[model samples]
Target: MTSQAADRPEQVASRRSKLTREREQEFFDAVLDQIRECGYDAVTMDGVAASTRCSKSTLYRQWKTKPQFVAAALRSNRCPRFAGIDTGSLAEDLREAARAAGGTSDKDQGLLQALGHAVMQDRELQQALREALVDPEINALRDILRRGVERGEVPADHPALEYIPAQMYGVLRARPVIEGEYADSDYLVRFVEAAVLPVLGLT
Candidate 1:
């Protein structure tokens, strides 16, 4: 026989009565802001409820747990850095992407850093982070590379293509850790022009 718990609906539809799309976004924003300021381990359901002016039961009914709630927030809050970017030239496209990524707000970086430890420990959070932060940018970068190949600007099977995303993203995150400096637009653009373009022979 199917267990009642197993058969239960994903969310309590009746208890979810109070939430609207706008209101739900507010809750998500509140939770993310708190996480950025307090770190994931320090944020509490009560704190979220109080700050959002919603009852704790509402959050519990919606997400069932803190990790789930945070994961949802992360996925919902993603601001895709690369979308609808094509500048005809691969070099310009990459420079544009660098500018966009390097323009990420300190708040965004803080939230990422705050979740770093928890993401490693929680599979769901890790998935949410990748879905939110990694996949879109990688897909966009791949599109840029593919377009270059089609234009005869780069080789179809260039080995560096596979590692381009990793290199750019790694350096962006690593700069702050290693040098206490956010990878600003100028720096990222220069890095791309110097390191990336030269590698692909697009320089």
Candidate 2:
């Protein structure tokens, strides 16, 4: 067999090995839903297989371990929810971001709480969680702040800029603990209008 003939079979095999996007999304959704319904410790590849009606070996073949599988699922669900949020005013930008974050706060917060202990125990899981959920919002918030500075709305040396991400994300996690409520869109928008904007000297 010539080199091109030998390569054809390998390429065909590689193509066959990959799952379609819709199928992969189904798996990701199934695993995350399981994690939400059952705690991270209670979730398993076998459970996901049963839930999705696939062979356990199929999941094991794609991801060697539970953590790896969960991490991949988390990553697959990643969306830059806070990206492309320029509204010509930092205050408005932040309010928009708050609304955006709050829209999924219940589900995302529940997932985070479910995975909290496990994530603390696994560095890969922690990083994956941050990549999937945390970093994108932080990066987008930073972009909003950077734009504010550029527009002279806020000084570049303002101390509050450093803590904006913490403040924004903190409330989403803290409200359930403090007030026994999930920070929904209305609540988050109110938070931005009341607590966040004032601290930054914006209306």
Candidate 3:
């Protein structure tokens, strides 16, 4: 029954893949919702499992801990908005990216707050967060800058073009902690107009 044995492995693999995908989605939704409703210190794998109708054992088996699980959650939520920005100018691009970065999502914000202390202690989780959320978004913006260079909208030698994404992300991430303020559109717009565009000589 070699054929039967091979078929069984394939079937099991497929089933496991499906289960993993479903559970991961459930876990991410549960984590974000729980973090939004409760503070970072208050969220737990047990709580997430109960909310998502999954076993705590399953979550532990997959992620090992809440920090690892949250790291995975952050990675899953990354979306690039590069294609939406087009004002036919470098100023428009920076402004567009900053504005987009500033609009804070409640669930995502809560997730970040919840992961704060955990991220400090967990290197793997921090790397995962960078890989999942930060890197892709930054890479997309970098691509935008590269395009601007090709179009001659921004010079290849411009410092602002090279550093705009960092400025955008740094402020977007740190503004809340720095000023105890939400990362709103107004702050991002001001940053773009005041600091970012000025560096680019766009204003």
Q: Pick the candidate with the highest lDDT.
A: 2
Candidate 3, residues 65-130: lDDT per residue as tens digits? Answer: 887788778677666655467677777777777667666533445567767777788898788777
How close is every model to the real structure, measured as TM-score? Answer: 0.90, 0.91, 0.79
lDDT of 3 at 75: 74
lDDT of all the models against the reference?
0.87, 0.91, 0.74
* C-alpha-based local distance difference test score of model 3: 0.74
Residue 183, candidate 1: alpha-carbon lDDT: 88
Tens digit per residue, CA lDDT, model 1, 165-184: 88988888888888898888
Which whole-number lDDT from 0 to 100 does residue 77 have in model 2? 85
Which parts of model 1 have CA positions greater than 4 angstroms off? 1-18
lDDT of 2 by residue, 88-181 (tens): 9999999999989989999999999899799999999999999999998888889999999999999999989999988998999999989998
Regions of candidate 2 where Cα sits further than 4 Å from its true position:
1-16
Residue 193, model 3: lDDT of: 93
Clashing pairs in 2: none
- Residue 159 error, candidate 3, Å: 2.9
TM-score of 3: 0.79
